[model samples]
Target chain A: MDRPIGVMDSGVGGMTVVREITRQLPNERILYFGDISRCPYGEKDLETVRAYTIQVAEYLVAKDIKMLVIACNTATAAALEILRERLEIPVIGVIGPGARSAIQHSRNGKVLVLATSGTVKSNAYPDAIRSLNHNFEVTSQACPAFVPLVEELRYKDDIVTGIVIHQALKSHMHSDADTVILGCTHYPLLKESIRRYFDGRKAVIDSGYETAREVSSLLNYQRILRAPEGEVTHTILINGDSSRFKYILRDWLPELKYDMKEIELKV
Target chain B: MDRPIGVMDSGVGGMTVVREITRQLPNERILYFGDISRCPYGEKDLETVRAYTIQVAEYLVAKDIKMLVIACNTATAAALEILRERLEIPVIGVIGPGARSAIQHSRNGKVLVLATSGTVKSNAYPDAIRSLNHNFEVTSQACPAFVPLVEELRYKDDIVTGIVIHQALKSHMHSDADTVILGCTHYPLLKESIRRYFDGRKAVIDSGYETAREVSSLLNYQRILRAPEGEVTHTILINGDSSRFKYILRDWLPELKYDMKEIELKV
Candidate 1:
């Protein structure tokens, strides 16, 4: 299908998936929606997240999207199944790809999952990992402050950040897990800090890169890949400010030129 | 006048000013515009920032605002003059208020300015301070990474944050300056960390609060203060995702309720 692939996230975290899709399927056009207004969906109730997800999906479907990528972990956990059943297009979530990567990398059979409150509460990673291999042991930790900290760009702050990260990781450090999964996409930006905290003792897995690879394979499997062109124009829509988003994006995905557009998502 | 005052910036940095305005003028209604889509006007060239400021000013004028507040340092530096010339209503930039605060608070003549590139490059603070009293020595530093760091919420992150903050403040630490002006709104969020780093040796001035006081004075001088009401609703407009903007706003300004609307400022 020549129609654009629709991707939606609670915020910029989903850009990781978009970055991947663009790389894997160079020719495909993507319509991305970053719901920056009510982001950090990990802390919200599941019902509210599901409703928001449905609203975004419906909006994209109206735009005639060929596929849907629920780039947000919380939304995927809360609404992916219903979204797939309700929509005619294939709907993919970040969980399965992340789980698969964790399973592949876990040599000790013990895996630690770090995500937002909603994703941890949903037990999505554990469930997904177990579905693939029942023998794999999964431990989940909800880093509530991580999303906000990342959004506020506090990744490098030493004193306060050290305390927060330490508090969040204290349990995982004592756990029997040797492999850790960055369940939330936003967590990837803190990979270096997280890795340092782990001090080479554990393998840190970035689900974003793996999720991107999964998206590539899926497009190839379905034979829906777009051909690479001379110049690809990426449109970034934020319900809020696009300045910081654009800045980080330039650092994260340097190839594509970003043109930010502001849109109103109805309450 | 019944019309609300219009305040705008590139992103959440303006909230510092908005917070003060709300506190000082509880009866007044504010229409705040955070152009999250094209935020951090500090890095952009003069022409781009000027155009963006005019665009936001025009939008606010269309809403029948009584006055306009350029809550962003970059916008103020690049476009305050043009805005005052072009717009019929009173236009206020953050630089003057900040400079005034620095001057009043400083026991010693030495004052340090920490702001974005645009503000530093424009030399607005020094010029404003010198305009008041040329004898006062003004030192300005352009902290380019500070906005992004604050936006990313890196204040809590220990190692990376410490490095960035230390680097930004290194030169100012040894200076004889008794007062440091947070020339950018975003700098306030890093206040605690900044304070801890400074160890209370120098008093920090928040431009937002000072700007709010200026806005109030301007309103009183103009005789356009609105009557106090039982309920005051703030109408927020974002060119991007309204939800994301609302999420950040709710966090930034918890006391104020926002009725968000989506707008397109493509021209």
Candidate 2:
């Protein structure tokens, strides 16, 4: 089967996952969809989230993807179960991988989840972590403004960013967590600031990396791993503009060559 | 008579212009398109830029927009003239407005143009500035990595961000320019950092704001300004997902409610 592994996010934030996926499964071609149109699913209602999630999933399925990775935390929280049930292929979400990693890595058994409002409200990470290790204490913080702040590329604005991160991490800082799970894929973009904020106190976990590992394991277990014979290619589809998305891929995956093509997704 | 103004960019960066246009022209509704599919037109070649620009323009024109704002700098440089000639409606680009603003604001008649490699290479701002005032000395710098850095939301990652910005702006810092025009739409997302980088030494001119002003003027000149009677609404269309885009919009334009709708643009 030469079909590609499908990964989707609200925007390029999922590129983090696609980058990891490429690194881990170099032989497997990946199809990544960034719904840059309806991105930052953090603040939308559940119905709207489900609608967009289905739209993207349907579009990717139409592309003949072998598997689907809900690379977005918000979408995973809102529609992962539904997608897994509805789609023919196996469906994976970032929440489980990230939560499991946090659970496995937490020294103090207190793990902090930094994610969008929708993710936190759904208790997706907390539930995933608890299911893996019942004794793990998962504290979730809704960093509603972080995505936009990052999206707007305000990462270097010390004063504004410092204030925002400080506000978002205030509750987490007071908690006894020794490891932080970047629940949302976009959170990795703010890793430096996040690490600095919790500097020396906690280890920051990237969902993208953990999810990639999971994908590798699942593919191997299913005996679906492609032989590293053919040249590995990654096709990135943006239902918006491919210009900025290409640059983002270059920045995040530096080693990978991004072939961004425009695709119109019917909602 | 109640038709909305069509504004398009490679990605969400154009929301800066959309926000301004909304603020300035409160009576007019906006049908905004962020070609999130092929965004960040800065690094792409001319042929690619022209093709993408025309694709977006045709999509917007099909929506029956009264005017078209090529809110993206690279697209403006690559396809503004072609669009103006091809379309029956008045077409405005950020370059002219940005140059006009830079010329008007520069106290010493020495202005700096900061944009993507494609836009800078096109000499769009320089051409526009010279057209307005021949004596104006315009220094242009291609901040290639800036857009990707911003898109990755690494603007707050102090070390990496500082290094990138320093490298991109190093050449311009040594110059005699007093006013720096953020020639690219995406550049505005990095405005705070860019401003902080050149703190107290120069005034940062945002092309989006200037473009909005020009858009207002053109509408007024064309006698197409909608009467301020009905409720003013803004419809945001993203070719990807609306969630993340909404987050950024809420942060950038706090007061406006962003009704995000998914748009499938036929290329």
Candidate 3:
């Protein structure tokens, strides 16, 4: 019952989800993995991305986590089913929750999905949203620059960040989408800019927040929630470099005390 | 994959969940049972409630449902864990989803739970909300009269209905609760009146809608979702008189085509 919940992403982007999980389920311990060695899974083909994701997931599974959360949209679109089929514990992904949130918020039955290129090509958000609600009209935009902006630590409210987001969403500025699903975990780091770029008109749905709520619901329903008195720990593993990761973690979660390590994954 | 989802409630209160399920997952079939013979499980002791819920769940499990949703809050508070342990399929409850929704919606930490006397006596809502996030300040008000208002078909907006709602929530008019949780399934039917009573100030949280969103997420994650091409069916079972149930179904779901039957449970 006190087992750590494993969270993984292509790179430091998944910290958005980890941030949320810490806030929502404070009693639970977290084991985070960021594959900085392969930071951009969004540009790869589905088969390659699936293989890389499985390697990362297998590493976490071997550590005996109680649950696994695929915090990367590209990885979730590629490998969530396989991981769930292979893992004994509950495996949750960010796609379904974001799609559900978009459905919940979109009053006009029109939604805009902002994601990485791989996720857009995979059509996971549109499929997930339309499956739950057929009447919804979905529009997907691939923000290839958005992830780079977050990963390069350029997510500040500056002119360059504004220009990047504006250029990415220039076409849908006047679209009828009442809800915007932040389909990528890293996109939440750029949430303020994206919202401002849209002039705060559309509801920006955070995949990490929705995913954290889903995790809480499933854990409680499964009766596997950690006891309130259990000791909480956070362990972060990065495949490439730990210096930048450490800086980002400290900035995003100033109060979170955790161990950061750099390791070479066999993958 | 075409297996139906089983939903059980104390009585017509569960219809709220069924309505949401139909709207959210149109391809999925529903098998619903109402223990109208013992209509109000809210007043019973915990042991009695548990026994009655298991009896109803076992009946649904025998029908080979792929999933089980405990639509009644009191029954969920009492029997969700036991049923999840005993049943082979996925079991979902309204309490966790409601609690999660309140956590997601409340701008302030203060929240109000509107439920039956048995649910408040069980201390389930407070425990559920606090377990997920300790910062929340929960206030539970047992509106025992609320259920009867819906069950006796006195939910219509009239002088009596207004008086009942006013008296039920009289003490909390000036309270600091920023969110109101409709802990009982039947309470959503009285949503408009409740919101009006609060003068559209507090955010009204519908457990049925939140639970339905969770059901969709779980089904998609488990890969048990019905195919888009699958022919959908709705079946309703009641342990006692069903003429009233049938009328309510028609009124609540005007376009739904369902098979209604009355049968006695051996319990």
Best by TM-score: 3
Tell me the tens digit of each residue's lDDT in model 3 across A1-267: 988999999998898999988887888889999999988899889999999999988899899989999999999999998888898999999999999888776778899999988999999998888877787899999999988888888887598898898899999999989999999999988888888888999999999999999999878767789888845679999888788888787888888868888999955
TM-scores (chain A) of the candidates: 0.94, 0.94, 0.98
Cα deviation at B213, candidate 3, in Å, is 1.5
For candidate 2 chain A, which ten residues in a row score worst on lDDT? A216-225
Model 1 interface Cα RMSD in Å: 28.2
True contacts kept of 2: 0.00
Give lDDT tens digits, candidate 2, residues A1-267: 678999999888888888777654566788888888777788898779989999889989998998899999999899988887798787888887776556545667888888888888888887766643456778788889988886766766888899999988876775788999998888788888888887767899998877776665455424466655556778888778776666665566688865778877756
Candidate 2 Cα errors over 4 Å, as ranges: A156-159, B1-267
For candidate 2, write residues B1-267 as lDDT tens digits. Answer: 678899988888888898777654556789988877676788999789999889888888898899999989999999988887799998888887777556545778899888899998998888766643456788888888987776666765888888988998877776778999998887787888788888758989898976775565456435576766646677778788666667676666788855678877746
Would you list the rank order by lDDT, best first? Answer: 3, 1, 2
Give per-candidate clash totals: 41, 38, 0
Residue B206 Cα positional deviation in candidate 3, in Å, after optimal superposition: 1.2
Instruction: Give the true-structure RMSD of model 2.
Output: 25.7
Give a tens-digit lDDT track for model 1, residues A165-252.
Answer: 9999987766778899998888887888888888878988877666655555445334465555456576667788777777777777
TM-score of each: 0.49, 0.49, 0.93
lDDT of 2 at B97: 70
lDDT of each: 0.79, 0.79, 0.89
The CA lDDT at B254 in model 1 is 76
Candidate 3 lDDT over residue span B137-243, tens digit each:
99999998888888888887578889998898999998989999999999998999999999999999999989999999889877898877745669999989898
